[model samples]
Target chain A: MPSEFTSTLNSSTLEAGQTQLKIDGLQLNFGGVAALYNISLEVKQSEILAIIGPNGAGKTSLLNCISGLYHPQRGKITYFNSSEHEMTHMKPHQIAQLGVARSFQNIELFRHMTVLDNLLSGCHIHMKTDLFSSMLYWGKAQREHIQFRRFVEDIIDLLEIEAIRYQTVGSLSYGLQKRVEMGRALAMRPSLLLLDEPMAGMNSEEKEDMARFVLDINEEHGVTIVLIEHDMGVVMDISDRIAVLNFGQKIGEGTPDEVRRNPVVIEAYLGEEHSPYPLRSKL
Target chain B: MISGIFHSTYEQDMALRHTHAQKIRLAILIVFLLVFPFLANRYYLTLANQIGIAVIGAIGLNILVGYTGQISLGQGGFMAVGAYTAGILTARMGMPWWASTLVACFVTAGVGAAFGLPSLRLKGLYLAIATLAAQEIILWVVTHWKAVTGGVDALVVPNPELFGIRMNTDFNFYWLVWALVILVTFASVNLFRTRFGRAFIAIRDQDIAASVMGVDLFKYKLLAFAISSFWVGLAGALTAHYRSIVTWERFTIDVSVLYLAMIIIGGLGKITGSYLGAIFMTLLPAVLSNLGRVVKGVFPGVEGIIPFIQQATFGLVIILFLILEPEGLNKIWKNIKDYFRLWPFSY
Candidate 1:
């Protein structure tokens, strides 16, 4: 089954020149304890890949490495954009500039700024107007500001966040704030979107809404998404392929059906005695 | 429709207006600035000069505390460095007044950066302590360095001349000071929209997040320090040249505290607040002095009570402003204008 998953992933690998992200021999350690061991992954153009793991399974660590928040001890993360440049060891903002954007596990919206301003800040890198032009409120600055505002307004509308557009993020509900964070990331107009626990701590309805939003973003926008989530049901339901990590090691990688029947994954999740889900329920 | 055009979030609403209304207002302000020297009598001209000097210093302090969110209790020190540098160059080296002023601003900015070095390692209370130490050290140096600073004795700065016009009259000096204040204020306002200005605000909001977002903290912080000191130094140079006198007593820790008070009483991080604060503080003493003269005529014992009452009132006002209206007089002005703007329908 693992071999079959590998073959599928291999087939998906960037037709020689179109891969969005490639990770090889990734490893991370906190002092003496290894947090990630030789984890490797690939995200091709416009693919939705899910990483599922239990608590302390090095899921966030991998995402951090990809986002340039943490440097992996031994790894090569090569990301190729449409510009024919492969980015390696770039800074977080530099990586962001190369069309990779991320939302945090805990939302990191600029709380002091209004929701509109937060979205506007995400477009800071894209703004063409200089400081002098902005200060003077010149023709170029006004035009550029209007353009960016239109773009941001479209995203806000798409996210269904128009009512609270002028409200501060600090005053928003947690679920709304999370959506705003997604909007902010989307404002960057990233080709590859990394959502860290996109549906974490949400109720069933909120999770369903978020799942629909993610699906719409992926299918309609054709954005390649790499997400870290704990909900196995959501992962199994949406992901084309899933990677399971246990104790800082990749225990299984396969389709949902293949992973469900794997004995090692069952043991890792339910322990030896309670391995079979149907049998345990009956007992 | 007017309010609709101006309607925005707190961030936008607080923005310095550059609209047609503001342009007309600015033109009127320019006219007022041009005519102020001729209209005011000698005492009023002297008062205007003091306001100009204070405004210059306040603008620099506002940049440090308001834009950068770095507490500096050492603006007085930077001012002293500028004053003494100008004083020594002109009085001893026979440097022209203008040349000395320019040299003084640069030298003092360099010294301000030296004082700003500890800010890289220290912040908040620790940063304030570093500045306080700078203030004390600078004052001690100016007092003890008899050769250059002339100790505590007043160093007579020569009467300045510009284009062969001797600035002997208060009106002439008033124009010079007013021009300097306006130029400095304009530059300071423009600085807010720059890369350095954004970085300063970023650091103020969240240093770690700012760094992660590609802002180089060290470079920007140091730049903020340098720019802040440069302005303060310029103010000092103007004061030294305008006064034609320099003494150690001029740049004491008290003056540093007073400058801090000005920024606080005006409003933190607002350019308009600085000007408002300077005018407010500079006029308070004159108002009290006039009141004192009236009371002296009415009550024989009121003469001794005036200084004590003034000092107590100053302290009480600062405390009141901090506790009751920490946003300072700027907010008050905004409220009044907003009330008028909204008129019958208050929001």
Candidate 2:
């Protein structure tokens, strides 16, 4: 088997609105600089959770930590799946095999490959045939590939990227590229999807389209979403719960309604009179 | 639109040949391959045989370089492993040629995997240099290992026989060479249609992203190296038996560079590209000599410069293609196909 993530997972642990991932005392450092400090957070199953903060607030670093890109020096990240696997020490692919998929802050679509190919590449885990079976490309391998192609087609349709499915990702516009990245991540059939600044560098209409897709991915597909967005209006509108970070520390985390009134989040964004790090926002 | 081509079912969409023209093209190709040996002279057959051998090695190289995006300069060294293995088994161990060839494949795969171990830490140019080091190391070992390898001397390969028929001639060996070439090429073409192929491309494009999508980097990288060298080893065994000699000198670093050149000119990431590149690169010197002969009558004094000019032309051609159309001959073939697919109608 191609290690398709689903077959190995415990199905019962995928219930929406339950605590899916838990991070405790997470700390990351780059020499003298601390990227994340004493960060404790919980992502509930199926809910849209947004991590919002100023630039250098460790929002991306948190996603990187969960995705196993950047290993934290201290902490425990537990993926509450059918089986409990410690995320903190696992390799990136191992964490990914746990049904955890992510998109990059900057779009990382395979520039040379077509949109369809990029999505199919995401189906690496599902198509588990040996070199012999694959080289023959008959019966089981063919069936599995067609099955996954159908699944990827749904993502292409959902994201409305059918027009450019055969086009190379390099030729796609920024908005379409981001959508393709989301589509690629979704092709893994993830239990938890980490989207890093998906709406960055987009017009309002593009942002609106992305917001709908994020909502659809959560509600329709029942996938848990952890979003990082700087557009406060979109974040406030879409996120069920929000976590605020500043200088690698968790300042506040609550429902968007609750987070909007938090003094710490406000102070982090619009700084105190003498603080030089005033963040630009529409919150 | 490609006229009269419509797929109502997923099975049709997943087919290797979906269109009537593609099936027809394949039929034509098969027919041509079958008939070529009869029409060509011994010299042309020799050239064709070289293409067949180079095609096998080039396809293997493509798997490592183009698909998996791992640059290996030790391909020649891996081939030497196959050549020596074939030489030892058929000559020393008294094994059959068929058995020796099969054994060489597995043995070479093992050696390639050992060399590929450093790939986890090294990448790009570093990996290339490491593989180069492996080439030098393998050559050194082959040169020094007197008992096992006969040490820097040529070992005569026994004639390959099928059902008590000793096939000693290049014409006789042409059947074995082309059969394996076609088989390996078929496998290579089909490989990309499956998940492993996609995984290789994914790794090539972005190893980090490929890993995050749940591809085991270590497994696939080693598999690429192993499988690639496995075929190259098969080619080596064939070469040893065909020439009726095995010496480590033939499988030099120069052969590896030539194989790289074949894939580059054929185009990266396409199976058909390997065929084009291999045939073109293998026959390029012959074509150049023919051109040089014609130019000799026009300029009598420049006979010594022909080899220099040929080398320069190869470099110039590669540079021009790299600058003008980096995708190579396969892309040109694709463009021509596209034109015909929409014949009498502009897109």
Candidate 3:
């Protein structure tokens, strides 16, 4: 079923194993409190780089800075698509136009619109018909609208959301809404996809489905992904590399196996298992 | 299940009128509109003209408030801009009616976009107040800018010459006005079907998500305002030409509230609501006055308070619609259609 969808994915313009995004000494503060402190990270092309951290570790904040939702007080975030694009100060829409798309931690599908319309909106930047042409609803406007509708239908098929394509997004279940959000992001034809806890609240079966979709998006779509996840099992299973943040700093960064073995990573999680305040006793 | 509706192609699926029944109904409507002038008397013709003008204005307001979810109290002010612009161009500067109306639309759209600047940082009730301020400011300019607006006295608008024929009678203006009403309605429907319309709705639904999904929030918000005001400005220009006068009193804060009531009662976010709302609101006063005349004939002493009763009834009806049917006339119309759609077999 998924083999046919290979044609739907844009042929990757990027060379394999190239640096896709580089974040340098990122500093973000809300008033006097620092959210992200000197976070430097690298995302290679078509890799699933999961950022795992405890609460308030600035994992989501890092993703937000890279996606242009938050401007870091000091740091440079550069995206490498066809060229090196300085994305530190770009607007969200401008960054999106350059093939960067993000799904919110909470599903942000247009509540009033149908599933299809929300996905169709993902094709907004690609569409070129002006107001007058749209008003006439013929020639360019009709062609573009139908073409994008076809594109959105392909995404709907890939996500296996055909049944709820016409359903209002607000009426959908949590898992379905999350899938729809991913489908909407995919509809943008993004080269870099930022997902904040894509499987935050879901059953094991739903979590497995989401993990599979995330892998499919990264591998099959040839898109670089920066994911923030709390589930250690899924993170270890699917992530190509893992970056761990604790207390607004990157505590450990390596391959999933390496990170799992690192004492620092284990301490951040289990917290000095044999020591006096072994994280469990503190909690 | 909806039976006998099938589409083999995307074009068919994306068509404005989907089913054969809808197309048939559209044909029937076109026939009715074409035959209306001949059947109706002069008084009804004038009334129809008024409804047509209101329909144009209400649809414009609905685009901003209903579809785009931007509450605006500047509809009346924008209309005044259109009316005054057209009045000055045609009556003061000797420009042709059509040309002046065209300029009026663009001018009003510019003003609307300018006022919409505050919307980028504002939301909901705060944004509504900002637009209300726009209404008051534009009205003040129109009233105090005496040399251009012709002081406190009403500016006289020339009867427009359409295709070399003087459009002085309600019979002549009715066709022109209704034709525009149809054109603007078609345009509004088309606007929503495309990406531009989707952008407007996206901003309304979720601004942050929309921006991240590549919708330029500031550009689209201003565009919504400009497009909305263009339709409204056209309505105002037509009103000026139809009535052969332009006055500050006609485009007051109360008039802005009245337009808001039209969209609220018509159903927000639906084009059908705009048409139904405009017709219902325009006809409401006329119906109440006729009822007033009948009551006066019966009592002979109730004439003095009839105006007050009319005002009170209009306010009460708006409140009733808000509380009882917030979705407006469009929902009721849909309910009627749905009930009959499945007939006796319906659950």
Candidate 4:
């Protein structure tokens, strides 16, 4: 059973197999160089979907487009929760306010802030105290602050980061910083969470921990997760669905078993003899 | 090294002062501040007033430069706006000092926000250059617009009267200024405990991530400018009344650099650092001149060198502080406290 803190994170949950995010015929370019082209994808509610691709394959670009960090020149991205939110033209912060939270590929944390404060920052949209009230921090401001502090504590507890909660994020280990980044995203209470290269630098043990947290957040908390990962073993073991990209184009996408058997995915990515990923049979 | 703090409630845990010792020490400090003017003479009272005003201004700049990581060199211009607004309101219209000061803060805040608009596109050195333009433009307006500002003639400010009591003396102004300092300190310290404070620091560290986390870059950046300028404006208003005059010469670019030096040498992003830096920067010249008197007594041929020595010392000390400890005196003080805190239990 989920704790009270964990259960209250998402205000609403979608039924399984419902379309949480729909991206149709999206195209992005940088001064004539295409970063992504003709990409169409759908993320189901309460499922772990992993995007696997080589470097420069536009995996991170797609996540950025969805989070409103990058503007795709063409097509539309729709996020459906309580209602449909046309996310293409909205500013990054406006998208975040509509319950879309993302962790960066390079661990974009408030490095000088304490881990607890970094997580509280993720609760920015939820916090409602005005500037004048914040200056006099007593009454409603103090009440709101303490209430959110309690909310962030649950994320800290779930991520098993209570030991370093008061330490600066910059001073933490790389693996720990990645965990804190996830904790920060979790603090946002997002119904749709996007993760870019979440396990890029983590060791096997840390990757297992992160994978478990992702699955738990998806299954227990009912958050729809779309992640980009390179490790085939972890992706094949954990993800409910997988999407493959090559040279800024989607080549194949399916359940792990189907993607593993797809001739195109095998030819373009998986068939490389000196691949970084362990053999599929090893998984 | 100090332990044994247990909070039974979240409010207790979130308190600015965590321990009974902290509360008791704060009480003693407050009592001492109230009684300081009584113990000191006029010279010390004057110095106290200067430090008090500097504290407010330095804390304001720290909010912009130190906490928000937006470098602004137009502090002098913002202060000028505050002084002139207060000066014009009081001397020309017969407005109350309190109301004028309040109006001055708002006017300066508006001006500061207008200048901060450039920050939405510029950063680092480019932003610094843009804010320097703000300083130049405001100074030019004050200098060229002779009709309103009195240009070269300057504006004479009358002493403020509160409850029929004239606040013309250094002793009276010391209490008034220090009271505001205390209030500003509490407000800034409290500001950091909330989401606004967190968002400012987050923007400083990583702006893109802050935006993705739902912090509006433009709004928070401008809000920082407005709030920071408000306090600086308050300091300028107090300075006008305390000096009984307002002049464009007083709000020069050098004054802006001095405030920046205060925050840098005291400690960036720290409230206590602002206090320490203000006291240190304000007293450096006085202390240097006192030392100069002894030097002149020994050799009466070095009077011209003494003024140059004071300026050189300021630059030298700032460079030395940066090289030795960029965290400023706050970190050094913490190191000392930690050493004593764990004394005789060396591990």
Considering every candidate listed, which one attains the maximal DockQ? Answer: 4
Write the number of the candidate with greater TM-score, choosing between 1 and 4: 4
Query: Which of the numbered candidates is closest to the native, going by highest lDDT?
Result: 4
| DockQ ranking, high to low | 4, 3, 2, 1
Interface RMSD for candidate 4 relative to the native interface: 0.7
lDDT of 3 by residue, B105-214 (tens): 99999999999999899989999999999999999999899989976689998889977898858888888899899999999999998888888899889889999999
Docking quality class, candidate 4: high
Q: Residue A1 of model 1: what lDDT? A: 24
**Clashing residue pairs, backbone N/CA/C < 3 A, model 2:** A1-A128, A2-A125, A2-A128, A17-A45
TM-score of 4: 0.97
Regarding TM-score, does 2 or 4 come out ahead?
4
* TM-score of each prediction: 0.79, 0.94, 0.96, 0.97
**Which stretches of candidate 1 lie above 4 Å from their native place?**
A1-39, A49-52, A55-58, A65-100, A115-117, A123-176, A183-193, A198-224, A230-283, B1-3, B6-31, B89-110, B140-154, B167-169, B296-299
Residues A117-159 of candidate 3: C-alpha lDDT, one tens digit per residue? 8998888877888889899998877877888878778888778
TM-score for model 3?
Answer: 0.96
Among residues 3 or more apart in sequence or in different chains, the pairs in candidate 1 whose N, CA or C atoms overlap within 3 Å are B66-B269
RMSDs, each prediction?
Answer: 6.8, 3.2, 2.4, 2.7
lDDT of 4 by residue, B85-147 (tens): 999899989999989999999999999999999998999889999999999999999988987
lDDT of 1 by residue, A75-110 (tens): 788887645444546666677767677788987776
Clashes of each: 1, 4, 0, 0
Q: With candidate 2 superimposed using the best TM-score fit, by how many Å does residue B94's alpha carbon deviate from the native?
A: 1.1
Compute the lDDT for candidate 4.
0.90
